[model samples]
Target: MKMYLISDNVDTKTGMRLAGVEGVVVHEMEEIRNALDEALKDRDIGIILITEKLGKLIADKIKDIKLNYHTPLIVEIPDRHGTGRTPDSITKYVREAIGLKI
Candidate 1:
């Protein structure tokens, strides 16, 4: 299972490359869509890492893809600017998903 990264900046791309994860830096929605399409067509790719900013930019499309496919699992990660998520977002999401406060 190979992991591919879709980065919003050269910084993230370079960092991931140093970690041995190959990636492409793209700044537009069309480019994201194209990269995702290409990645999906690749049977070898089992995971995709996308920057938070670009992930938010294409949230709807990504949601649909996640629901429709089970292979390439798409994961959103923080970029050079760090995560855009609120400090409590994970706790809040966990609470919402299973009705737990912790």
Candidate 2:
């Protein structure tokens, strides 16, 4: 199984490449969708790393994929500009998951 990345910028792709992962940069919805579809078709790819910005841009589309498929698990990662997640995002997620505020 392999991991592939769909980054929003060249710098992020370059960084992932240095870490031994292959990826591409895409900015538009159609472009990202196309990249994701291509990545999903490859059985060898078990995980797909998407930049946070791109993920946010197509959250509904990605949600549908997550609901319909099990392979090529998608992950949202920060770009070279750094994390876009709120500091409390993890706490919020945990609260939602456990049905209780932390």
Candidate 3:
């Protein structure tokens, strides 16, 4: 099993490349979708890392794939610009789920 990446920026792609993960950079929704489809077709790919920005462009499609398929686990990763999530989002989620503050 191998990990593949679909990034929105050259920096992210380059960074991942140094880690030995091969990937492509795409900016448009169509290109992102096409890249995702191509990644899905590869049986050797067990994980697909997509930048958060690109993932947002096709959130529904990714959700559907996650629900219907078992292979090629899709993950949303932050880019060089950093994460789009609020600083306390994970804390908030934990509190909401367990009713505890950390």
| Candidate lDDT values, in order | 0.93, 0.92, 0.95
lDDT rank order = 3, 1, 2
lDDT for residue 3 in candidate 1, whole number 0-100: 94
For residues 1-102, what per-residue lDDT tens digits would candidate 3 score against the true structure?
A: 999999999999999999999999999888899999999999999999999999899999999999999998999999999999999999998999899999
| Count of steric clashes across candidates, in order | 0, 0, 0
lDDT (Cα) of model 1 = 0.93
Q: After superposition, how far is residue 29 of candidate 3 from its true place, in Å?
A: 1.1
**Candidate closest to the true structure, highest lDDT:** 3
Q: What is the alpha-carbon RMSD of candidate 3 to the true structure?
A: 1.8
Question: Where is model 1 poorest over a 10-residue stretch in terms of lDDT?
Answer: 20-29
Candidate 1 lDDT over residue span 1-102, tens digit each: 999999989999999999999989998789999998899999999999999998999999889989999888999999999999999999999999999999
Candidate 2 segments exceeding 4 Å error: none
TM-score of each: 0.94, 0.94, 0.89
Candidate 3 ranges with C-alpha deviation above 4 Å: 94-102
